[model samples]
Structures are given as C-alpha cells and as structure tokens.
Target: MITAVSELVKYYSSFVDAELLKAYLAGSRSEERDPMEHIEAGVQWICQAQDAFECGGVARSYSMIYQPYFRKSGWFAPYPETTGYIIPTLIDYARLVNSQELVDRALRMADWECRVQMPSGAVQGGMIDQASSPAIFNTGQVIFGWIRAFHETGEPAYLASAIKAGKFLVSQQDEDGAWRKSLSDFTMNSRMSSYTYNTRTAWGLMELARVTGDEEFEEAAIRNVEFALGQQLENGWFRSNCLNDPSQPLLHTIAYCIRGIMEIGALMKNQEYIARARRAADSVLARLRQDGSLAGRFNERWEPAVSWRCLTGEAQMAGIWGRLYQITGQPDYLKGLRRTNAALRKVQFLRTDQPGLYGGISGSEPIHGMYGRFEILNWAVKFFLDAQMLELSLMKKSDIRLQSNGLGDVASAN
Candidate 1:
C-alpha cells in the first residue's frame, strides 16, 4: 500500500493546477485557500514567537497564526507545546503543498534553532526580539518539529538540527529527576497547567531517541518523565500553574501529559508510566460519556469550569486510546477510541473541499483545530490507505506500527 506521505506529495504538486490556484490567479471565490497559505499562516505566527528567525520554522500554534487575533480569557501568544508539535504538521503541509519550497522553508526555521541554541540546554519557544531563552515545554515541542522535519526528508541537515535540539533538552535535566527551574519548583513549573505541553515535549524526546538511539536523549526523557511523575496529584492527574492562579486542571493539558507519558511508557518499557497513563485514561474515560465527549477544563475538585473548544483534547485522547489499545491489546481502549473518533468526526476540521492535494479543512467546531488532530491528518490518510495500520497492539505480541507516516511520497510527473 502507498504511504500517507506519498498522498501528501501528490497533494503538494497538484496545487498549481488546483481549482484554488485558478481562483487565486483569477481573483474569484472559486479559489480555495492554498495549503501553504494554511502552512504560511501557521509559519507566520512562528515568526512572531519567542524565536522568530524568519527561517520559516513555523512551529505554529493556533495562538500564533490566528488572524484578527483576540486573546483567550487566560491564553497568550504561542502555546508552549504546540510550538514544538507544529513542526510535523508544517513539514507535511510543506511537502504536500510543494515539498521543496515549503520543506526548505521549514528547514530554514529548524536551522535557526540549531544555530541559536543556548548553552543551558534550553530552547526558546518563540523569539523575544531574537534573544536566547528556554523552556522544557517549548524545547520539547520544537525538538519534535525539527525531528519530524528530519524524518520527512532524511536530510542530514534536518537530522543535525534535531540532534542539536535534542542535546539541549538532554542537558537541561536537574538532579532531582526533573527538568525544571529547580526540583523544588513544582508549584507553577509543572506543565500540567498547559494542555499538551508535557506530553508533546516528552513524545518529542522519545521520538528523537527512538530514531537516533541516543542514550542521552533516552536518559533525559526518563529523567524529565520522572520529574513529571513526581508532580502527579494524589488521585492521578498532573498539577501545573501558579498556586495563585485559580484556573487549574485543564483537560487539554492533561491529554498532552497522558500522550507523552504513555508513548514514553511503552517505549521505555516503564510499566509505571504505562499504569499511570492507564489510570489517567481511566480517569478521562470515567468522565467521558456514552455520547463520546468531554468537558474542557477542571479544577482540583474535578469540578467542570468554563469549557470551550477542546479539539486537542479530543484528538489526543483518541490517540491516547489508540496507544493504550496498542500497548495492552485492550478492546476497551478501542471502544474508547471509537468514541473519541466519533466525536472527532463530528468536528469541522475536515474541510474536505480538497482545493489542493495537501490542503486541510479549517477546523472550527467540536474542534478549535490546532496541534491536536491536525497532526492526525497524516495518520488518517495513512490509515485510510492501509486499514491494518489502525489495528491495536497486544502486550503479549508485537507493537502496532503504521509503516507510512504520510509525509514524503512522490507524485508521478504529469
């Protein structure tokens, strides 16, 4: 079967002849949004982030790219984790939207990261007037993007870039088995405050280690994880945010923690991480209903507060369920996954008006559409092409692996 990346390549090259292109060229409504427009929209935000180098390393977060931007009641520029997580989405979008131009632009951003890395083994999420800074959360997501760029192209340049980010993360670990300002700084330092930050970053670390077999990467992942575990609440659930900040216990942030920890758990063979993930999954599942939906954010008391579009939460929860099923071979997880996917399908992210091969729907409904299932667009493409890729793994048997990541297929010359 053909891989998702191949489909993406076809998507990218078709843009010139795409109806959207004609519309844009003709100044008509017949023009759909360019996939690169989407990618560029994303990348443009990256340029505004803590590390805006203009290299096109748009490790975009919806926060970065949202035009006519208005801040959330409690949100700010560049969601920390998405900055890293958007790497693959942008790269794939770049590839499918014209691989050479977009991917090279993405590579330029990745290149900037390699050059400006801090000695503290810390990386910046976005640029602060072109200054050096770092955060475990931002570093993780950025590393993830850089690594995915490498994976898509197999270019030494991308790989080298990823290694640089990975090495910085590895060096940032603290002695108390956490990667924070200090071991005692768990109060507001925990990533639990930010949905998907910990998980994406952790997942990124594992990705780098898995591909490169770098012991340091692995060790840093382990240590950073142990630190996160230390921050877990008594009943399960990661704690993040300032003690003064009344808003806490976000479902989106928790999902990131869950995915990163669970993926790392399986990869590291850490039963504890696995068990913890299961418990969190169970916690989430318990809260989930027969209708396949979840509340947005919660408090320490498990009280639902102001709920909004939690697209990332739903999508990652599906991914987490898929991972759980893969690791334990549990049908329950699959059922849970069906629920998540069902809910996800109802969301409006599938702007199926395929104006271009690689163009994606602008998600607005059940999903706010950034960094969550957006990443899964590739997974879905691959899954659609190869149904077997969706099968769960059995702990007693082999791991579930999708052969094609939907990022690098070539199109036939027209």
Candidate 2:
C-alpha cells in the first residue's frame, strides 16, 4: 500500500490537472447532471473508432497517443480475442447502414484472424504476437467471428476455421464439461482452473453447432453450460469470475457469465435458464446507481466492492437487459436499457477532430480505475456499439408495435 501511495503521489500530477486527479484519488462518486440521449452521435463515434483501428493497422486496439507512463504512441497490434467478436458487430452495423467500408473492414479483420490461427486451432491470449500458446476463451471469441463471416459470405475457409476451433474447444473439455486446459493467464487464480465465464465458450460452440449441424458440438456446449450453472450462487452471483481479479469479481466478468447463460437459455428454449439469468440481472439492477452506472467490483452477496464503474460492464449489462425485455416484454428492462445506454452516450467523446477520443469508450469511469486505467479498450467500444444497436433495434420494434395499435407516440403505447 505504501508503494502504491508513493507511485500515485509521484505521477498523479503528470497525468491530469490537480483538481481532477484529487477527485479521483479521493474516490468521488458525483454523477453526470445533464445526461442526454444521442444514438446518432454514438454511431458516429463507432465509425471514428473504426477509422482509428484501421490507422492502427486494423489489428485490434490502439493506444490513442503517447502515454506519460509508457511514453509510446500510435496504434498497437490487433488483439485476436476481441477482434474475433467485433466481426459480427461490424457486419451487422454495416448491413444496417449500408456502409461498404465497414463490410470490407470486417472482412479484413476476419481474414486477419484466419491467418493468425494456431495449428491447434486456438487463438492466443493477449495482443497479437504475444504468445503462440492457445487460450480457450480467446479461441471461442475468435470462433464467433469466423462463424459470422461464414454466414455473411458462405466462405468455406471461414467455416473450416470455425469448425477447427470448435473441435479444439470440445477436445479440451473435461468429462465434467469444464475446460481443464488452455485457460488464459488473464485470470488471477491458478492457470489450470476452469472459468465460470467460459459459458461464453458454450454460447460460441452452440453457434458453431447451429451453423454446421454438428451434434457433438451442441452436446459439448450443453455440458459446458451445465458446468457453469454449478458455479452460480443461490443469490445469483458467479464465483471464480474475473479477467484479472477474482476476490472482488469485476462486473465485466459477471456480465459475461449472465449474458452467456441468457443466450444459451434463449437458444435452447429453456425458461428455467432464462430465469437464472434474470435472477442475476435483478441482483445487478438493485445495485445500479440512479446515473445508470455500476460499481466496478462486487462481493459474493452482490454488494459493491469499489466505487468506480466498469464502463464495459455497464454496456454489456445494458445489452443483456434489452434482450431480457424482448423475451419477457418487461417495462423495467426497457427503462434500464434507456437509462444505461444514455449514460454510456454521455461519456462518449463525440468530437470527430480527435480520432482516439471520439467513439472510443474508456475501460473504467473517471478513466483512472483499477482496470485499464488511461487506456481505451477495443472490447469496450465493441460492447458499447452492441448495446446501442440492441437498444435501437428494440425501440424500432416497439415503435412498430405501437403503430400497429394506432398509437404514434412511444409514450401512448407505454
């Protein structure tokens, strides 16, 4: 603690003005007063980030500019894990807006992923070229992209790669449905242990099964989901979940687990699994601040472990809530969707002049929290774009329902 304090005292002033730094250091929780809804602005921000990604070599994420701490500038290598799932978002948006550039960009990303696939069919953890070792989570994330590409263009290569990845994941799974090998070092616990959040792996595998008519993949995915469900506490909190820290699990991982379960439930037509996801979602909803942000970490009982907000988690959870609303037609889920998505828009830097700040979402609120401090994460923007897309899609569907009932205004339909 003393070393941490000394480091903070030494470099805090170098990063920001004293007042802002002081507020962060003091752990202030002041909310934005005049938050507004700006979906178009958000979409424009997404475009800017995409341009920046291309400037950064279309690998994955960029560091924006030089950091006083690292003293480096320009874009870094593309991240394999996030670059995988980002494909679907890019393709969907491209279709929605008729942007050929984005479609081309998504293709490039998908092609890059195919080039980097290991002989074992698993993508490595961390940034590009970090390691040759395969990681289960990273492989699943990339598989999601490969399958999406196959669906978009009927490219046999994309399908072949996805099939290879799915086979690797299935081979790695233990008889109990837990992945015992190929876990990433990103977790704080022992590297050999399995993860609750690999419910995402199950979801991705399910996608592979659906596209390829592979019953083995489907059965493997179901087993993995069954294993993940065993980790959920009666209170709906997931154990052994976090990218970096498990003692105080990040909302990001919690959201991952919840979304994966919810998706599996939807795909399998299992109301019981959906109810499990709703239980966890309600636990999170109870903790959301009036400003639509959540604490970055939480204890097993669903209490806040930190004052800072994980912006990525907020966006992911918003998407989950939107999905829930679609399934159940619940008004509260709609309210949560609007409030959380609006909060995200409030934080987006809409100025097109600065490519890095515009459309890029920070990893943490106040921009100096424990996770991804001072850096904009690629997955952050990907999930934010996803949440916004879901929100808009739901709103449009709601509008259509209202119109069919002879009500022009959303308010009247409510």
lDDT of 1 by residue, 356-392 (tens): 1222222222223332311222222211111111321
| Global lDDT of model 2 | 0.73
Mind giving the per-residue lDDT tens digits that candidate 2 earns over 186-208?
A: 44366327778888888899888
> Cα deviation in Å at residue 296, candidate 2?
0.9
- Candidate 2's C-alpha runs over 4 A off are 1-60, 64-74, 185-192, 399-414
* Cα lDDT, model 2, residue 27: 26
RMSD of each: 12.2, 5.8
Give candidate 1 regions above 4 Å deviation.
1-55, 59-83, 89-121, 127-132, 182-200, 241-247, 349-414
lDDT of 2 at 142: 86
